[model samples]
Target: MKILVVDDEPDVKDLFEQRFRREVRNGEFELAFANSGEEAITYLSSRPSEVVLILSDINMPGMSGFELLRHIRTDFNAPPPPVVMMITAYGDPESQQQAAKLGANDFLTKPLDFTVLKEKLRTIA
Candidate 1:
């Protein structure tokens, strides 16, 4: 499985790499990083079918995750659209509601719990 993680923070790539190292080493999954929503959009445009899942931070500079979710739900026309999971620092009910309204498959709060995430991935896989 290929998972695209979108976040504005530069350290996120390293963090995810470290967290999912076992999966990567065993060829269970591949990880890709995009710094912002625009970058993610560009990546999706180029390889619409490659990514099976997207883990996106809700608060970003250029484009918010909600906007990205809207785009994923409305703009992307690829078959079997990638499952989207929204991550936010603030676990506010409004934000959760917005994410659900925008069609997110799941919602996660940072600092992400990889144990739970791994289980979620197992279910999806």
Candidate 2:
């Protein structure tokens, strides 16, 4: 399971890599990263076969994760694995509903609880 993490924060990428490094099955899951939606799109376009999951932050500068999610579902058609999850500081009910309607598989709140996120991730993968 190759995973692409799209976020603006470098720490987020580092932390994720650190947390999951021990669990990954000898590179079965390679973690790639992109700082913005445009960069993520570029990576995806170039190596569509290398990505199996996406962990994206909902708020970003240019194209938000929601926008990215919409693009994937609408443009990528039936071939994509779907977004693994989205993280956001704003846990509004409306936002959650919108994410679901837009096809987000799951979500995590900001100040993320890694234990819970890991369990959820395990359940999926």
Off by over 4 Å in 2: none
lDDT (tens digit, per residue) of candidate 1 on 1-125: 99999999999999999999999999998999999999999999888788999999999998999999999888774788889999999999999999998899999999999999999997887
Off by over 4 Å in 1: none
**RMSD (CA, angstroms), candidate 2:** 1.8
Q: Weakest 10 consecutive residues, lDDT, candidate 1?
A: 72-81
Residues 1-125, model 2: lDDT tens digits? 67788899879888988888876656646788999988888888888656767888889999998998888777654565555578789988888888888888887779889888767666666
- What are the lDDT scores of the predictions, listed in order? 0.93, 0.80
| Candidate 1, residue 43: how far the Cα is off, in Å | 0.4
Instruction: List clashing residue pairs in candidate 1.
Output: none
TM-score of each: 0.97, 0.88
Best by lDDT: 1
